[model samples]
Target: MNAFKPYPLRDDFTLKNRLVMAPMTTYSSQDDFHVSEEELHYYKLRSKTMGMVIIAATSINDQAQAFDKQITLKSDDYIPSMARLAKAIKEEGAKAIVQLHHGGRMNNPTLYENKEDIVSASAVPAPREGMVTPRALTEEEIHQTIEDFAQATRRSIEAGYDGVELHGANTYLLQQFFSPHSNRRTDAFGGSLTKRMHFIDMLIDRVNEVIKHDATEPFILGYRFSPEEIEDPGITLNDTLALVDMLKDKPLDYLHISLGKYDQSSMRDQTDQEPIAQKIQTVLKRKIPFIGVGKIETRESIDHALSLGYDLVASGMPILVDPNWGETIQLNQPIKTVMPDTLPKPLYDRLAKYRERFQQSGYEFPVEND
Candidate 1:
């Protein structure tokens, strides 16, 4: 039971097991950006069997809100709702982590009263269809955004969460700063890879400063990042390796790699023979724990990811289909990889689109007839 073995993150913080529930956007919060009953229930239902549960990407500032039902940590007023959500997950015996995020250019213009409110690393429009060109954040605004992350960390600690995971993946603000394709700034924030990394470095420093000054309990800080992007000037394996080298000595609890498959090869450089995670680990040299995630749906996939030198394995779709995944593993019972008909209507509705996509991807998450 390697999966069930307790894992120490720091002297003060440890996981009951190595199984993490990867953060998945729920879009179940209220229009006011408050945690909703459905969202709490969603987490409570899934938290029972996991060592740690990373909540969906939550907006750190009001203007950063991107989705209609996104959760927020922009103000003290929202702390109560966050506390309730944390309590719901923690009561199930899992460490609750809220992912702090800013949508940047990915922000929906419709959410803002003024369209120019949307901001990113540069004024470049997102490559995604229908996305508007975002306003480039000023140097002061960039500094302010880093402070916003620190504020969010303080709020997470106040809300009784065990930790906060910085959302640096999925083409968001952090990735926008790191990706040359998105960032055209000529200033200290973007140009050379080192300058591009300045934003992330400052961000980590600020968040850790907040934890050092404020956190009274054992708090873990983790970072999640994508390894590669498809654009010519986008993040490549070499760039990711460089970034990993920079982060190797940071006071981070873990580095989570965002991928579609645990063993997926580099998208940009076909000449690279190793998996992206393995490459990252090579540079990291086990300085910190690495959490690998993709379409991991079975016990065998979890075992394989661990065998590949990942310190922990995370799953998203499998837990959505089977809430008791870890409990079943502990009981030595066969795991169910398909969504059952008895799944709550709200949850099933939330997963409908993903269910279709998972089916097409050949990952078995069949939806039983209601």
Candidate 2:
């Protein structure tokens, strides 16, 4: 349960330690969605103490963007942007991973002039009040979107990242296709459970194809997934377990189970006391390395997570607030709050606004400059 030990990935890379900086969006990119100087400085400050740093969800195409300042790899022009961030992380002694993503129905239409660009598995609105309904992707569009992810993978490889993580969690495009609540398609991409998973299956296959043909060396491929959804008729633990079974068979280097708490149980069935991550691991049966992420900041929580069979532990807010979280945990020292000067203005402002909530959740927020 030593979180500081170096762990080898299935690929050629070996993590310097088992504590990962989870992908958490700062929403601080430049106007054209390139990595800003602030982001590079942020990574440089934070990457020194982590094994792997999974960059926040980045748009694979123009239509994939969700946040105003989200990072993008939609075209070759953006390759330098990612390369700069990768250089920052790797130079600081951590494996750099870019999380490729599409927003789907969650995309804010205001970011696009053409509303039709906001598309998903079906023409359904997200299950939130006053949400905009999205256009359904045509068969050709679906095929192209799959290619978009492949192209994104190629770009990540070219950008000098050690790995690329498919962002299939958090109700994004990938999860939209898999969720019965959002997807109402009847074509080859929807219907039975297997059909619903067709998009992810093809997406993975195409990305792997790109990696095999394009990469000169072994490049890591990882998948992140939410275990369940709150919406009725939405994804359940059984569905996620089945997904885990299929993913274990894929060439993915690891599986990351996204959760709000490290040991959170089923949301769909409160009576099911077993943690959703533990269930997924049982289904995986050690076929793939699993990364468990959530409110894990202290050495005790990290050890607790490892004791539950997780191969690695990840933290988002803790790492964001304290750059030396890994070193603090390793040395059993108190985690200190970062100064406001270390964070991007927007991220700092947002955290400041939600300071109380973050503190309640056990995160140390950035403090004001003395």
Candidate 3:
């Protein structure tokens, strides 16, 4: 399949091409959890090349925030803020997708002024050192959380977005509710694998209801997920395969697998060498579009991903480093490895602190030596 060709979705929504901008958190929102002018500029700068741009994870509520400076869609009041972001991307001729998120156990209490206790499916702390054990939500709160997601979807529609991607990957609230390591509840929401998926299943149902009622256009809905977790007894390949089975026929436009490399193999079982994306695709069987992302930098890498049979490809860091990534690739221009001085300070500092990550990926991050 040609990478530059338009890909059509249900209800007449067609992507300009098979390339998408992966959702990446910038830590650049305003104090009130609204999109800052800097972030709008950032999106506007990066939106020109892709068929769709999935904005960084935005909190669904105040409590859902995982870090300081996260964008929120917690209430109707933030609609205009999001509308501006949607307009920024859409005006560039790319579809804008908001990633609706809740931090759950990953919520850092210090980010909250009062330091509220974080909630999860159970009272399990993340396996990382110094992590606090979270409070399990009462059954009532679980239902309320579902409603929160639905309301956020409604806001995204009103804000003029082309779609919303449920932020289920990256060990966030949705993944926490599904992971055996995080969700230990004995109720209908946890226990067996089937039970652990209850929260996600219900959440999807609610979000769909909102789309059916609120969306004036052919809105896109997608789900993103990690194929496995490194923690002991955490999500495994088999577990994710089962998840793909459940999500394949759901009211979704695509399934995006989060990974360090698009063709990465199983982490838990090193002996299983099959790339996890290919495994999930075997189960998906073309039921829904599959977006493959991870270190997809150059035109060659994008072509390689397409050779692997992905329906669409997502570009992450390359777009951040170079706003004109697509244009450069189309013109056979060299991609930049150095971090530009023009980025938002927080995002720049964060990337600078972790410059070694870029080096490890064979991408340079040469900063100006002032």
List ranges where model 3 is wrong by over 4 Å. 113-116, 339-342
Against the true structure, candidate 1 reaches a TM-score of 0.94
For model 2, how does the per-residue alpha-carbon lDDT over 149-268 read when each residue is reduced to its tens digit?
Answer: 999999999999998999999999999999998888899999888888999999999999999999986789999999899998899889988888888999899999899899889888
Model 3, TM vs. native: 0.96
After TM-score superposition, what is the CA distance of residue 149 in candidate 2 from its true location, in Å? Answer: 0.8
On lDDT, the candidate that comes out on top is 2
Candidate 2 residue spans exceeding 4 A from truth = 362-370
**Residue-wise C-alpha lDDT for candidate 3, range 1-370, written one tens digit per residue:** 7777788956488988888889989898988878999899888988888889999998997679897788999999999999999999999999999999999888876775554458888998887665677889999999999999999999999999999999999999999989999999999999999999999999988999999999989898999999899998799899999999999978999888899899789989899898887788789998999999998877888888877768899888778777877777767677757556546677877788888887776767877732
Candidate 2's displacement at residue 53, Å, is 0.4
| Per-residue lDDT value at 5 in model 2 | 88
Error of 1 at 36 (Å): 1.0
Which residues of candidate 1, in runs, are more than 4 Å off?
Answer: 329-347, 360-370
Model 2 root-mean-square deviation: 1.6
TM-score rank, highest first?
A: 2, 3, 1
| Per-model TM-score on C-alpha atoms | 0.94, 0.97, 0.96
* lDDT of candidate 1 over 291-367, digit per residue (tens): 99987666777788887779888887767766787787567665445655434455567666567775664546654
